[model samples]
Target chain A: MSSTLIALAAVCAANPFRVAACAPTSTDIRRQAVAVATALSVAAVGLLAVLSEAILDWLNVSGSSSRIAAGAAVLVVGTRDLFIQPPSPEPALQGWRAGIVPMGFPVILTPALAILAISAGSERGAGTAVGMIGAAILVVAVIAVGNIRGTYWRTATVGSAGVVFGTLLLLNGVTAI
Target chain B: MSPVSTRVVRGVLAWILVLGVVALVVHPEGCGQPSSGEVNEAAVATVAWFGANINDDGTFVYRYDRAENRPLGGYNDVRHAGVLLSLYQAESAGIEGAAEIADRGLAYVDERLLNTPIGLVFGRGASARSGSVGLLVAALDERRWATGADDRDPLLLALGRTLTGVVNADGSVGASINTATGSTSGRSPFFTGEVLWALARLHLTFPDENFDEPALRVYRYLIEDRDRVESPWPPVSDHWGAYALETMSRWPNADDLQLEPDLELDGPATRQWLARQLGLFGLQVRYESQRQGGITRLTRGTVALPAGVGTLGEGIGNYLRFLDRFEVTDIDVDALNERTNCVAHLLTNRQVSAAQAQQYAEPLRVQGAWFRNDITQMDDQQHALSALLLLEDWMPQ
Candidate 1:
């Protein structure tokens, strides 16, 4: 179960949220989708590697303390995923601009993901985190290109990932004790 | 197995694995409990730090910044006497060279000890404070007890007598005095505890019936009257009073020490006072232990100063000793153990090795000294060394 959760969370974390946000209408904009996701993933992981420590220091929060807070947030998100039903699809985003719209901002680079990036980077160090994020993005790009999941399976996979991430977060926080 | 059952089992197993890994990593075997040998090593190292750091004149080095390798100047008489007292404790604990180190300190004190109309006192003129005199007297009393040499040092005995002279009829010791002129420095908050502790030891060592009336007077004022609460001195938790209570509890005639039937000496009342001090100055630490695996926070408090924390340890230790001798059952031993362990761990962690100190100026390279936040001071080493040495007994066997 732990192994399965780790795999699923990786996939879910790497999933190009733009693909879901753009949906049926923006499927033809494949080049833009791949380009934007790859670029954003690189930039996000890079920023996390470089700035998280300084930011946390500026906030007067120890790395260990922030790790605890991050774990709690991840736990809440994971618990939510386990219980909540996915909402029905929103209206399909129209035109090439959809790559940058709700998909790029909220779906792809969420607050949780941003937090996860910083904490993971802190725990794993910059080089490992960058590789992990890059690999996650590559896997996400392949999945987005394949566009091969039914809604139920996608939801289940994402939810399973949440469980794994939340458990990991909880574990990280507990170790800090 | 059914699919759900299999999945649940796997999940539980994974969680257990993570938890186990965390526990193993964060708290390896023998993490909290230092071996008796390690305590000795650390104690020896601390004594070595003291030995390496004292000036030729016998005054301990006041402060040194390890990173910059610089000496920071400042000194306090009470802390100097406190360090002297701790050295005697170290010698009794069988730390090598502690007696020599203490002798050097005594020599320094000898220079400061002056003949006054009242009695033998430390420091010059207006600067000679009762607390310093009390600590020096107490150190002398401890040394006398350990050696069991009946021929007393006249200066030490005189200091004891002089300390008794300062205890007012109501039990408060005057804060400071012009040893030359007998001028008063007025009453201070902490003097009662210092004076009480010294007088209690004075009585303990000499068995002087004359010392009892004044000792009891101070005890009544400190315990029954709660004089600090009424006086301008803030009602701060007094570790000195706690020490005195512990001393009075073990005196040969323990029952006779208590003047009033209802006056609490070293029981719940003493615990309450010590607990308050442990609460105020104690630090609550939350740190990551990789072995625990999950996001966890442990809020455990331990007293954290060199002087106050060390004094508190002795105070609480005496309380614990009192409880065990009387076979008192109501007190919480677990809480005492936790506090003991926390302080022990803290003292160990804060210790600055001689090798570590060698990075500083030639004079500052006194290994085995303890410091906090890169700043080392004489009192810091004195208190922590005393606390750690006392911990040999307070910690579980």
Candidate 2:
């Protein structure tokens, strides 16, 4: 498979806010924030997909190299996710602003994820958009599981999923060369 | 939020290093790199192929479609000179029998020279293109440089005159001379670069001759006018341009020659752009490596013709030689070397081996030849030989 789905899956798998379900914020607010983040991500990634051709022309790189770079972006996040603790974004920020900041910007829709979307989207077109939607669904499901199943689920995911998928992400990127 | 321990990071890094080392050992060509020894051997085999294929009368098996098991009918006059030039390069590389093989090829070219009003050209056809004349000059220059043989000096000078006729006063290049009319017509940027290289080499051999001014003007045309007047976007892949640029680097006070009263040459910019073109050639090599049959071909694209692919080697190889010979410090030498090495590695890896050639209907036809879509032309070896010989020193051990 192309690096698109792999990168998307890796991004979801390494989502820092998988444990955000355990936060004291109300479930409606949390879901609303996630939905807003997803919308913003879709809009930005869509733009990147369209502009990818022009961007590549400007940079004097190819679609293949960009995809390779997309894979490398995953590796960068993979290292961060494997080692560093997920940022504890305070609840002092309310509404969709949380989605714009900690959730959209860092947790769900990350730099690596954006790169993957742009490259994969440019290369495979609808295939990447479909993968992005699939990843968003998976990320939401992980959080839902954490909310329903409580701290035990959150602890298990935080302890294992990031390390496992983060390693996979690194492998995915390494395979690019 | 705690970061992973330094000890853990160190342990992980150690494992990665171990895995990487093992991977490299298991499949050394993983990065598309080959040692110098293999490339040198391949170069010998290619020259041997040339030696084996030459007819008693000096004609080569110009184009062979292996699947058809027959020699395809067509001959390129420029390629005749080209093959001779490669043989000279091979001889310089110390490959045995290369000079002898080149002597036969040179005889064929000598017999084909047709005199025109301006000077003698290589063909008796309706038109004798400047490119063929230019290549003829280059081939002669290579022979002289390799063996110090000046017996054919008259023929070389005559061809140099023909090429000079194609170079206009303003440095722009004409396409060809009408053999009957004795008139020059058309414009070709590529033909101009070929002439430019010929003039540069001619100047080196006969420094007292006025070949330098023509060469400088052509160089100026390439830098300033070729793009505007002749070809547009998706510029030609120019091994000749690379050769000309590199040869210019060796000229006495090359910087002084780089200037004109009305137009100042941007030497660094031209080198960078030409270097970028070489990188484009390297890109083709990389993409070609990625291509495979079945579903992979659909994704990665079809294999490039071996002649076309061989030019990738020629482009980067000449550029590398340019970099090393002149030691021009403007471009990133390390990166250029790496790109050159990678192309050498991939080309060497992809070349037909003896054992593999045994499976073909005619071993000689298939042996030591690079084919794409089962078709191998004379130039597949010609360009590859030039590239391989020039690339020998730069290759990683």
Candidate 3:
């Protein structure tokens, strides 16, 4: 099982992109966006798995080396999360749809997530479990950010989880090398 | 010039001077070079030591702590067969006492030989492993070629035949076998390679038509389904694969072997591929050297383990064989040779001295063995000895 995949999944689940895109929406609109975003996230995981070998061959890199690089990227994201404060929510942009453009196209289905998905796909059981967990986290984060009793505690929890994921990827990368 | 500009120039000059001094100190002339006769002398000493150190029942004393100078572990057939292969190679090269040492190693393997309905196998009960049998077959072939003896001809051929079962119809080889049930246990890239080499050698040594198809099957499996079978994917410079390819390329009427187009490296292609893989190891050492102080010593107070170094040596040595045998021209053989020389020098430096010999109660002393602080394993000597033997053949005397 790849720690890198789980770490990347954690990163994707806690990403600012989704929060930034959906933060301005109404309660009903946000719920619809989360559902659409979750579907995109799961689809991206499957697509990455199918195309991983071809992508690696095109890049002329081995799976192990790619995992190491992905692990490094995850570490960078985690470190950034640890030090920086979260951005304040903005009013919804004119002509912006909730799911298809920002949330589905780029926020949930990112290039970094694509790389992690492919690498993780090699480990079948682990990848499935993590991908499901990642989708669940996205849904929960969307619903809980405003409605939850302690939003500060939610932010702290996300930050702590990010640190743990980063550390695991970093250690696994070192061991693989 | 202004005072600031003058100071900047002085600072630039100072930095260059410091960098130059560091470079010179880090890589001195002949720093990792072994003496001309050093490797051969060590090889001979190693061959002699193994002969003297084997127990009467034929298994070797497995591990040694050079600092304590004492034997430290239980014996096993896999390492025992590896020692046999080294001894056979040394003897084939006319190294004195190598034949006698090889004979002792052969005795150890012979004791473990099993006669199955399919063919001759090595090891007993659940401990019987196909990889061990493959190594024995290789050793016997070398012994026969060196001495021109055919007394064990039938047994040798049969042992080679037994390996057919080790490989599945799909070409994946079970590394170990339960001789009692004739069932395979575990699959690995390493075992697949060892059996491939043995099968190829069996055909080359005897020119039997029967061995060809089996050899081809293993080769196909290795090249095609490597990712599926390789435990750790992106298989690194697998030396056994290098050896197997070299053997197949050099076989009589090699073009007639009817290899798959994708698998067909011909002579030059196989040679270049092996050399390229070996070159990566040199690159690894260079990367390590820039980050760590030297190749011989690992950082954090740990010395380089000879087994690891020797494994690299063996890979380099085999790569050299391809260069020599195929008369390969495209690759930079000299640079690769230097990489091997660096490893040899490290192994030679790490060998225990005569003055240090008395500390160990063992009669053989710690001679011809490489150590990491205190401990050395048998494969360390077997591989290091083989690498030195290759170096002797490689260098112009």
Candidate 4:
């Protein structure tokens, strides 16, 4: 697999959905605002994708090593989330800050996500890999708003997909006998 | 689905993931970089594979089908000689029983020799290949070196002369000799190097003979003409060139060794050529390291055939021998050493283990060999064995 896509599946599995769901905005405005924030996340991710080749060259790292590094970072994040119930990450905020805060920052633009973005871009083309993530985030934002139930229950499907996919990508990178 | 059940399903999956990962960790036999001890064990197993498969009639299985549990047809005398060389090398390295097995293989090749104007070449009539004859000389020479015996000197001199019979004045080498006519014809990029290597070894064995001249002349042809004139795309990575230098590097008073002046060969020039050859090998090792069974294949390219990668190991191991004895400038010894070890690591990772071989109908035929899918060839073991033995000491303890 493109280690990046496995990483993408790892970081995106349930993160944006929960982040969008827990957004403090009213449901009416939430989808539009999440869309805006998600587009911004896609841009930032695309930026990393464009720079990934240069970044790797500067660091004297190869594409395979970069993929492993990205897998490792995503794995750690996913594994941590699996054991500890990750809080609905961003705090409650008012105005346009709601979109930019939780959804744009940590929920959408997480460290694991950034690593996956660069890796995907490096492995596949930036246009395709980042576009896939952009498309995924856009879809997750709509689902998050439409499916929100209650803060106590948290629309609550477990996002073990990240953990599962992270494990898959990590093992795939392991040289086999 | 209700939220409660959804949460329960997710919880179940999380626990299952944990259990699955645990299962993998506990039973991951033969994965990742093998320790130096494992590398030693791996080499022993590979040597065992050669000993186990040499047929009663002196030939070997040639190729084998693990899934079908049958010996594949066809054999190359060149590979036979190559394997024999590895056995002798193993014997030299303190591998028990290797010399006995090598002696048996040597006798088999000895029976196939054709008396030619060049001396005695292996194979009969029109089908004889000088490459095989070349490797036979090297194998016989390897045994003599290992045991310090001259009992084979008459045969070695005859076979060594057989290699020179094919060489023209400008260092061009014909790979095959027409036994009926006592003539050598045809050019092979591969035979070119192996023959050159054999000639170099011949020079060392009896420095008084004309063996050193052809050996030096062949080195000149190899470094200058083969690629630009013949132009095999992606150019040939001549492991035999490295092997020849290794043989020469071990010569007494090697530091002051001199080649014919008109041949334009010198220590600095030889060192540079070897360093370049090693560069090609290092690149191949790195590329092989990137190969995976997943989509990474789309990016990294599919895994190479086992023997092809194994040659990289052989090349690096031999070239490293050159570097160690001579001062090759602008090379990173540690990085080069690490890359050499990476080939061993790659070979070790790809080799069929005892556990995995049990899935085959015949496990003995399966273990200690590398297969592309279901089939493994003689050179796969031949090169991997030579590589493991050649590079064994450089790997960390």
Candidate 5:
């Protein structure tokens, strides 16, 4: 039990999902992986709004007004992005530096990840939560390098797939609510 | 390039080689004398010079000429007190002038100085002043043990008693004492640890029941019952934690106290922590490069300057000093070397007026700058002194 606990703690603390994904496989690989991971994580955060109720019921959690409020915030952001006319590409390109800025920071691994951490921790115990986080980090690492040389269609497909998955999660959350 | 210019460049290169050799010769490593011996000699010179100049009452005019003669005067008391404690660690160590240095240092401490809290010790002069007292207490305790003196020097005894007064009924030491109102500041780990380390040493030396009570209380306050609600630990509290843990480890009956393993990270763990902390030192180098890349300074900045760019230099210096005293080896000396070289480069290249650099960077010179700068000197001197004492102790005499 102690060893299990230790392993869990190590996983949680290690956050391997982010770690594996974040490693610089190569410059080209880094850029592609980060783009895919960022789109997915952001979409995941957005889908939380649609699936908030389900998430709460599934986890058997309550009295987290703050969590609901945060979900609303993510919903507003995702909705705005979906509706708003796309801005000039130059500014967007300048904004998202490869692996250093949004991709490294708030996008792939962020406060939402931390929130997921807290939820995972409270529900499944700290060790399991940490392990999940590690898994997520590993996922990020794989995605970071794997998508680098893919064509624009492949990149768009990955982004579209993330949006679809996020929408499904959102629907589940709402049904649960 | 012209022949004359080429010749001049060659001359400069040759001169640089010569200077490098000279520096290496002057500060040789692994020599029979040990590094701490050099530090001790420097510290003693600082103390003796201060004693001669700063009258018994701890008041003196700042004479730049006299200051030039003893450039280390600003840091003399604090650095000397630290070295005195280091010297106390040596087997067959002499405590010849430690008492006098302690007396001179203690004369400055009063209710007014005692009122300032620990965090403010950096901004206010209280930490440096109180820290000197702490060092002296540790030194005097060692002196008493070495000499088998039943009654310690009266001044030293008085100072020890005064330190006790700094502690309140609760384990905390009042930040500073209001001389007029006789009031004290709120309790803090930084002050409490300084007081505790000193009191712990004194208790070990004399086995006083009175000292033990507060010492234990302070120890508990600092370690077991830290402010976990707001920020896992209190700010400016880790230094105290490190000091308390290290000092406790040295106690004859330390095994009685069940300290947490995490708090008492072993040498390797501690060294790793030290390495991570060195990253901040690296950041400071980056910050310096950004700030002064194109700027020119009069004096080629070197290792001897008093300005501390960041907490990393101070942290590295403190940790190294602690490690040396604890006799913990297996440290990543290469990492330390890299960090030290970074700091050396910063100091050497730091843009300062020719006059200021001339005065500040002179060997053994102390600036009237903040105590952080002064602490760098104290930390370096003590680490060196401890290393020397360790070497001397192990020497096959």
Candidate 6:
């Protein structure tokens, strides 16, 4: 959605959205979306490097098979983004409800991201996971403040595009391997 | 000011004024002159006598006379070789009389007893060689004091080196070889104890870099070696044990000394043992009866029992001297008093001829009768002058 893209763009411009991705706050829906996306990126990078083998084992897949699957998923997302036109403009929401689903769930809590969260929870125990989640929420609340300005969205648009291109290269590399 | 505060301030001011007046009236130079000079002179004389009696080969003869010697020999015969070494060294140092005595004694030892253990036992199986090393070390220090001589005797150095070699790494010195056949069977605690004492004395006096290790090893063995079980005469050999313990305890580095657990004895136990051997003197008064009633008097031309009481007196005197030297306050004076009382009782009760009593008791007196009566006279006296050296530091100003 246009609204979602604008929120992501705003996050890229205001570094606060990077932190907010792991935490959520009562903020504009687009701001929350940007924060969630940032959290997903962080979790994905962490899982691939630090806990790749454990993640694969937990998913009941070999390391090589998991890498292949991740590459295919990334390729599918990149292709869809590059070729497809969105059908509807995203609806803007003003409060906490908007942050709960799109921003707090899918953007930050994607399937790969969920795997990482589960692995982190298992590694550090449930108490540490709760503490980490609390910290993430605090960070996202602070980041959401920047969403009030339109200039932030313009700058964030370029950054999000860069991230998508990088993610595409990463997927190609994984597929080649 | 309030009346009370004013009174307190005035009182303090008056006290200070009185102290100032007293200090001005008492001259330190006048008070110190006689005792200090006398002590120094006595020290010099004692060192001189030791030097004069030394033989050429590093041993000392009893006296100039050979015919007057008893079978066990004279007091000098028993102790001179060991005592003279310090005297000779003192004389060499420019202590007026000490140099002559040291030279004479050194010459005598060189000529008569070089390379033989005869010097080790000058009287009554008293070890001359082992005792000589200690005496020599003491003499060297005296000679340094007497003649201002800085050059140490190489023979004395060799003697220490040889002793270090004889002592095992574990601290035991091997038994002396039988003169007839150069074979040793078991160790003699007396000889070993004396040797360790000498080594410790040498460390105290000359204090070379090499002496520390061997001295500590020997000290540990003598004071703490339990399972190496070597002493044959337990009762009679106690003086040596006390001597070693006392000497080791006086060493500057004693705190760093570690002994085997089995060998480590508490201070009380060691003190008790020394008390029994030295008589009930000062703090060690538990065994007063043993020395209390024996042969209280001696007469002219009296061939009486050799009341072994003198040994205890001498031992107590030595212990006191050690305590005084080290400034040790943790001693039982009751023990010392009991021993002193016994000796005093013996002396007072005996109706012996003055000359006979003096002759018999002189050697038994801790630092000779002169110092025994008046410590002020201990300066140049030649008996157990070491005791005086220790006491001088503690003397009331």
Please give the DockQ score of every candidate, comma-separated. Answer: 0.02, 0.04, 0.01, 0.04, 0.02, 0.00
- How big is the positional error of residue B252 in model 5, measured in Å on the Cα after superposition? 1.6
Of the two candidates 4 and 6, the one with more favorable TM-score, higher being better, is: 4
Worst lDDT run of 10 residues, candidate 4 chain A, spans A149-158
Docking class of 5: incorrect
Candidate 2 structure quality by residue, lDDT tens digits, B197-295: 999999988888889888888888787677667765566777788888878777776646647533322356565566556556655654565554565
Query: Who wins the TM-score comparison?
Result: 2
Q: Could you tell me the TM-score of chain B in model 4?
A: 0.87
**Residue-wise C-alpha lDDT for candidate 5, range B231-306, written one tens digit per residue:** 3331331443444555665667654544454334353434444443444443333333323212212222233323
lDDT of candidate 5 over A27-124, digit per residue (tens): 66555645554455444433543354455445433212222222322232233224332211111123234343334443344333434444344334
List chain A TM-scores, every candidate, in order.
Answer: 0.74, 0.70, 0.69, 0.80, 0.40, 0.38
Query: What is the RMSD of candidate 4?
Result: 12.4
Stretches off by above 4 angstroms in model 1 are A1-177, B1-31, B149-152, B227-235, B264-305, B354-366
lDDT of 1: 0.60
lDDT of 6 by residue, B104-187 (tens): 555554543334332221222323344444444445544655565666556556566656655777787665533333223346
What TM-score does model 4 achieve against the real structure?
Answer: 0.65
DockQ score for model 6, please?
0.00
Candidate 3 off by > 4 Å? A1-177, B1-31, B116-118, B227-234, B267-276, B284-301, B325-330, B355-363
True contacts kept of each: 0.00, 0.00, 0.00, 0.00, 0.00, 0.00
Which of the two candidates, 2 or 4, achieves a greater TM-score against the reference? 2
Descending-TM-score candidate ranking: 2, 4, 3, 1, 5, 6
